[model samples]
Target: MVVMKKMMIGFLLVLMALLSGCQMSEVYDTSVNLCIIVANRKNQPDFSDSETLNTSLKNVIDSYGKVQIIVPDGAPYIQGTYSIEEPAKRMSSRKAADWRDIQISSMYNILTTTRAQTPEVDLLSAISLAGRWLDDREGEKQLLIVDNGLSTVGLLDFTKNLIRVDANTIVEYLEEKEAIPSLSGIDVTWVGLGDTADSQQSLTPVNRKNLECIWNSICIAGGADSVTFRGDAPSTGNNSESLPEVTPIDIIAEEPMEVPAKQSRTWWLGEEKCQFLPDSAEFVDIDATKSLLQPIVEAVANEDLILGFCGTTARAPGATEQGCQELSLQRALAVEKLMLEMGMDMRRIGVTLGRGYNHPYYINDRNEDGTLNEQIASANRSVIIFSLDSEVAEKLLKE
Candidate 1:
């Protein structure tokens, strides 16, 4: 009878141990709101970080979470949503691994079906859709964006000369259209900011910074809790032309130039002739500078023509945008002072500003070996005369 009593106590302890284990597992169970956006287009490379990405996948697989996938801004947007549920009963490690396999497979299948959903990628619209989806979720929210932040469509279209526009201006426009997302309380991470694939022009350092700043502004304006730019940038990008065509942004530096003449509507008075002292806006030969401006003055000499002088300088080491703008302003001012002395009205001279390296009328002055071509760069350092009557002039002047 004593032996039988001891056996009952042992059985009770075993059952208690099992119950304790179950409680611990339940305590650790967590759910996450994970939304991933993949921009599968011609201009963006694939998100090719295997190790880190697999780890992210594993975390979602091991927990009770909501997964959302989006391919944005085509003729129509594409999205897939799935929920991860915990098993009702505890299973062995092998079974758990098998469960993760099933989950990943299902997710992969959904991604496979999304490839043909959109013709091009529109990141803003995707973010808007993701924000709404996350609003429905009931857990810690996270969004992972996998693409070059350069959007080819919608209000933030780079093709529409949006690259030259400032971030604050972009935010204002987005707000006006109500296109910006409401991402309140959500953490946003972008994997690729300026990483571009072919049929797309590569971003310069300034262009990349501007690209990043614009997107960051948009996300912050949309009320995101945190905006993080993180990346495992892939060395190799997809160069397939079969993907939807993304229009290349026309960099002013790469545009063709026409010679300035007495009757010419546009004037590109280059540095070789204007002869400004090196690193100084002071004219090397005052008469030479006057001669260069004479043609522009002759062309826009009439009452109806308002001339806008934009000064450009060659790219230098460690040049800031503000500094470049200041230099451009100084150079244009030097010419403006001369014009004012020559009896041109200040009101008729619409813009006398420095463009620095931002507005290069001449093509890339950098050699294949990454050295500056002095001759090419000299051509780039010049003044562009814009007659306010022309469409291009009207556009820049916002008249």
Candidate 2:
């Protein structure tokens, strides 16, 4: 009787262990909630890419507890969700197969409907809305973004000056505008970025790098746990095959220029004959100034170059000496601010000075009455970028 009791106890223990193992396995099979946001802004959508993404998505959703497709162009962000059944008795093989088929069919329908119904894509709004939808949702969350990642409309327009802005500056702007979304605990995957035909114009190598950097920073700033990019490589097209492979401009200082100790070399901005507006430091032609500054910016970034801004102004009618000096200082400070905003390091910029009506470039071109020459007075009312390193002349020549 004692042996029989021991045998029974051992049998019960084994059975309990088996049941516990089964429960652990079931827990491991828990489902996830997947959110997909598609950008449908291209003139011609790539159906092949769409199909590839859909297949991958279906594979992911097969094990998901729930799935939501967020199509931004629609009035309501959620386009559809996979049908989920209530927890009950274990399903038979036949029933499980039927459920999988139904879910896949539903996913296909959702994709088709989204592609057909979406008219224009507003990327920022879509992300904001999707983030709101996912907030406080249950289950493991995943966000899959399908778009070129370009914001064509609203405050974050890439077509405007936004692209030229630095990544940190862009993030600050978005935050100030209350445009960033809360994406904490979400894993984001960006697809189809820089892949569409329409993106050819805007998706150069540098631009693509900038876009990825900006998006990555934005996602991190918005509290995303992880961000991944799975997009087509940026292509310059077959026409690029016929084009010549241009060499990179060498901006290094080949031979340092000779200069006296404590003296500087000056690089002027405007025509020798033109003058800046009186009491104003703003760039008269921003585009032209940008073009000229590009090389200087690059040289400074690539080499050991230190830059200083000296603002000088011609004596304006009734403008006191102090006022002129103050205006000149403001102009020099303005140039420094512009360069800093354009992504230059602040450490490289030094010594902003204002010299009012002093050391004119064309002193001999004065009017017959010994007053400043109007034709060449504009030259004096300018910002002079100088470098203490005499080597800058050689570096500028290489550029």
Q: How many residue pairs clash in each candidate?
A: 2, 3
Per lDDT, the best of the predicted structures is: 1
Off by over 4 Å in 2: 1-30, 39-41, 47-64, 74-76, 86-98, 116-120, 198-202, 232-399
lDDT of 1 by residue, 1-399 (tens): 999999999999998766543421223245777888874566666665534445555566666788888876465354767877878876655566677778777776675445524565577888988899888878678887777877777767887878778999999999999888989989888887787777677777778888888988999999999998876766465645656666667654434467554332566677767777877889999987777677656555564666788888776556676786687678878887887777676777776667677652436777887778887888778877777666546544542
Candidate 2 global CA lDDT score: 0.63
| Cα lDDT tens digits for candidate 2, 214-317 | 88888899999899888544323322222222212111222545664554556676444223354577666666666667777777787666787777777655
| Residue pairs of candidate 2 with colliding backbone atoms | 32-65, 274-378, 275-378
TM-score (C-alpha, index-matched) for candidate 1? 0.56
Residue 102 accuracy (lDDT) in model 2? 70
Q: Candidate 1, which segments miss by more than 4 Å at Cα? A: 1-30, 48-52, 235-241, 251-399
| TM-score of every model versus the real structure | 0.56, 0.48
lDDT of 1: 0.72
**Model 2: lowest-lDDT 10 consecutive positions:** 242-251
